[model samples]
Target: MEPQLSHHVEGAVATVVIRHPAKRNAMTAAMWRALPPLLEGFARDPGVRALVLTGEGGTFCAGADISTLQGSPAQAQTLAMAAEEALAAFPKPTLAAVRGHCVGGGAQLAAACDLRLAEEGALFGVTPARLGIVYPASSTRRLVSLVGPATAKYLLFTAELIDAARALGTGLVDEVLPEGELDKRVAELTRVLVSRSQLTQAAAKEFTDGRTDRDAHWAERADGNPDTVEGVAAFLERRQPRFTWSVAAPGSPSSSGSPSSSGSPSSSGSTSG
Candidate 1:
């Protein structure tokens, strides 16, 4: 099959799978270009509480397809950066479920997610040095934030792959699991995320990302919101809380699905690249 980004929503979780197994799920330029719009759509959808980005088969992304980088390297880098930025800016929580090689652009995308869960034997590397390409400043900063300058330099300077254990120790991945437990753990965590308050999640995302100016804005949103009241009542009654607030950005289409709604999901795929 042609390489593509395939997505499907099940309840509150939307999963985007990278499918280019012939090249170990390397992303093509078109795939990189498609990512921002896909993430924008999910950001607008009230029903999408969480997102999972992963690769087809057992491997995560292998980076940009080398053939596409042979010419117009700058253009390819631009598209990859755009995609990484989009993923980083997505309002909802996102997790990268990694199992195999995550290198170059692949590592870029994974690092953009809010969290990363890797299989025990997965490998990770930032490989711009291998191709003699200068990594973007923004990406370098993000890598530094996650793994610290020392660890980030080690990977960037040598383009050497690190095992999942070292990645977890460096904070490049949040969790590392045995081979068969990734999907189950991902599902469990996403279900917990879906059960939480969007008001809390959205505000925390902003503050943690260094947006100090949004305190009053989030406070205003929290004020008089039913989620707080419901949470208290649920605690008193020893019942599960039902968070009702959903993010509906301006100019985006509205959906009937609320934070607690279990609406039927739909799937789509794009084979452009």
Candidate 2:
């Protein structure tokens, strides 16, 4: 069966599932191509404030479908890179909820997300070395940025699969939960994110992603935004802030599935695995 990307939205959280259970959720070329549009939809939907990426059948993703590689290597790589970049650039916060194997391209996709929450038994690796394939420099840099150069080398050079504990220790994953607790934890976290100020999250995301310089313009832009006012007022009142900022608008260009032009945080494209 062909692999697929399934999207489900409830309230402010969207869940993107990668399904290819026959091969432990290995991503097919078509699935890679499908990601950008699906992610675009979520980004434009003001109702969706956060996203959770995971794999079907208790496994995250094993990587690119190797069977398809012999047919169209270049196309496969190009599409995969495009999807990776889209995930990285998504304006809202993204979390990778990993359960089982997350290797090769799967590992790259997880690395692209803003945060990763893994099951204690989850396994992660970057296996291009084992396949005699060159890992992309951009991805390497991201890995280095996460785990530092020495640990990045240890993973890439050896192509060894690391357990979730080791992954967390190396900074590969942000959190590790017990076997059955991942979904609950992720859902709770996304809910918190959704209830917070979108304006503040968006600006913080841009700065942390290193896409914007700190300047007076940031302060200028926030001077009278409703979110800012509500946040401050709520703090003074000792009550939870009801943030209402959203990206959706009638006739907004984003609604048509075009890339947003609002200078929102965008993903840095992924390097081919």
Candidate 3:
């Protein structure tokens, strides 16, 4: 089957799955082209508080579908870079639930996400060196930020496949779980993320990504928001806070509701591309 990007929402969390079992979820050029718009849709949905990126058939992405590279390598790289940037810019907290091979372009995608969780026995590498292709600067910077210059150099220079344990030790993956437990743990973490304030997460994400100038607006934005009031009240009352202040989309009416209480996000849909 052709590789595709698929996503579904459960409650306030969205899962974007890479599906191409015939090639161990290797990404096709079409799949790369499809990601930015799909992620934009997710960003515009106020109810989507967090996102999880994974792959079907028990594998994450193996890398780019090399067969497509025979036609136009530059096009493939450009599309992949665009998708990586979109994932990095997504406002909500994003996690990559990695299993099996996450190498080459697959590794680039994982690096772009805020966090990575891998199952035991999973493998990771950046194989541009092996392919005699230069890695993109943005991806290299993100990798260096995550694992530091020394380790980043090692991975890029050697193009060696590292196991899940090594990935975690090198700070590439935030956590490593047994195969059967990966999904449950990812769901649990994402649920926690959904229950928190989107305003706080967005601000923190921006600041951590080196936009310290945005810190000035954080206090002003937090001052009148109901999320702070509810959070404080819930803390005093010794109960879970019901955060209702969903971030409004550009030019859209602001809506408020307890995401935890709601069965799911207001919008729930899936598409393959």
For all candidates, what are the clash counts? 0, 3, 0
* Structural similarity to truth (TM-score) of each candidate: 0.93, 0.89, 0.91
User: Per-residue lDDT for 1-273 in model 1, tens only?
Assistant: 788998988878999999998999999998998888787777767778889999999899999999999889999999999899888887788999999999999999999999999999999999999999999999999999999999999999999999999999999999999989999999999999999987788778778777788788778777888889999999999999998777754422222122332333345556457
What local lDDT does model 3 show for residue 30? 84
- Badly placed stretches (over 4 Å) of model 1 are 249-266
lDDT of 3 by residue, 196-237 (tens): 988778888888888777656677677778889999999999
Give the worst 10-residue stretch by lDDT in candidate 1: 252-261
Q: Candidate 1: lDDT over CA atoms? A: 0.87
Model 1, residue 255: distance off in Å is 17
TM-score of model number 2: 0.89
**Sort by lDDT, top down from the best:** 1, 3, 2
TM-score for predicted model 3 compared with the true structure: 0.91
**Order of candidate numbers by TM-score, starting with the best:** 1, 3, 2
Residue 107 lDDT, candidate 3, scale 0-100: 95
Clashes of 2: 3
